[model samples]
Target: MTYWSGFCSLQKEVQPIELTKRQEMILQIVKDEGPITGEQIAEKLNLTRATLRPDLAILTMSGFLDARPRVGYFYAGKSGNQLLGEHVRKLSVKDYKSVPVVVKEETSVYDAICTMFLEDVGTLFVVKEGGILIGVVSRKDLLKSSMGNQDLQTIPVGVIMTRMPNIVRCTLEDSLSEAAAKLIRYQVDALPVVKEAENGGGLEVVGRITKTTITRAFVELGEEATV
Candidate 1:
């Protein structure tokens, strides 16, 4: 069952099938004495099994109860963390990736360096004219290229970038855990989030994901689980 999420007053509209006074009593009986049979619960309440059947069915369908053909009913609270883990796994790159900082592969090294500073990013995605990803440049790469008294304005960044076929990337459909693993395994400051090109045979850079983004996601997840 799904919830009607809200910040406050979950008492009323949270459950689609709201429990009645009798149903609440039945739930407590099941919690206190389960893997118990329906007949046992009815006997404890001094009611007939037919009269309590509907309430049992409602609670089970609403996810407050679970029934097995031979094992009877048991509380489902123990599986809450498992459900939360599923939510984390379902998060995708598109939900967390930030806007990409991009520069043309042919852009002057001086301009690319300025773009990096202006964008406040440790890395920059290098793209061709049609926004197709071709290479990547980092601050360390720029520093190394500048050490020989080179003409930054005359040289294009493409000459100093980590070229295609070596770039570590992830698509938007990829899960957050997959992206996180790539971030750790590759030891890159950031990843270019891309999608298949409309014309095929290349990828178009759409966004970027970094360590900070994943950390923030962890913080949010913790806060939400606690709440």
Candidate 2:
């Protein structure tokens, strides 16, 4: 039987639901031990019946917990045939394309632009003299540098690149959510995916993480994790 029948019968009208921490805690409690009552939950959590009422109401409304007049509350398994675990597993980053394009630090801005256009990407990784990532150059950066007196054909990317100490990077194993959060937090469109060098003094650009890459990965693989 549906767990929400009790609350539904009482309300008869639809209402909005907002789950708070306390409500979430209560839901966990019911999932762990129900056919249980709000009073039982309150007693276990050391909260009064009055204080637990709102939490119970919210949990019931949100479809996480269902209430019954006398049978108490119970954990409702996934609605219909949907499996929550399988749904989450399908959203993993392990199912997508993640290769990043890169370039050497000494390469000319002209070369970087050419690579960007040829690869149909917006950012290029700038590696050190040893093929370690030291910077990144975006299409806009090259365009800005080329708009004036700078000679794009002769100018090295390092001159206009977002260099070390300022470049934000992500590890190859970071979660897509975490990478996306960092990009949003830093206001950057791309991140260099790097690995620590064996000597422990530098990082090698193994790949690149960009918004477009993330989006495409999500669309193509049905996953959101991309770093």
lDDT, candidate 2, 1-227, per-residue tens:
46688778767665555567787788787766665777889998899999988777767767777654544676666442233233323333333326777887778888889999999888888876556877888888988988977778798988888888788888756666667777899988888777888888799766767788667744643332221
Model 1 TM-score relative to the real fold: 0.66
lDDT of model number 1: 0.84
Off by over 4 Å in 2: 1-97, 220-227
Global lDDT of each candidate: 0.84, 0.72
- Please give the distance, in angstroms, between residue 81's alpha carbon in candidate 2 and its true position after superposition: 15
Ten contiguous residues minimizing lDDT sum, candidate 2: 80-89
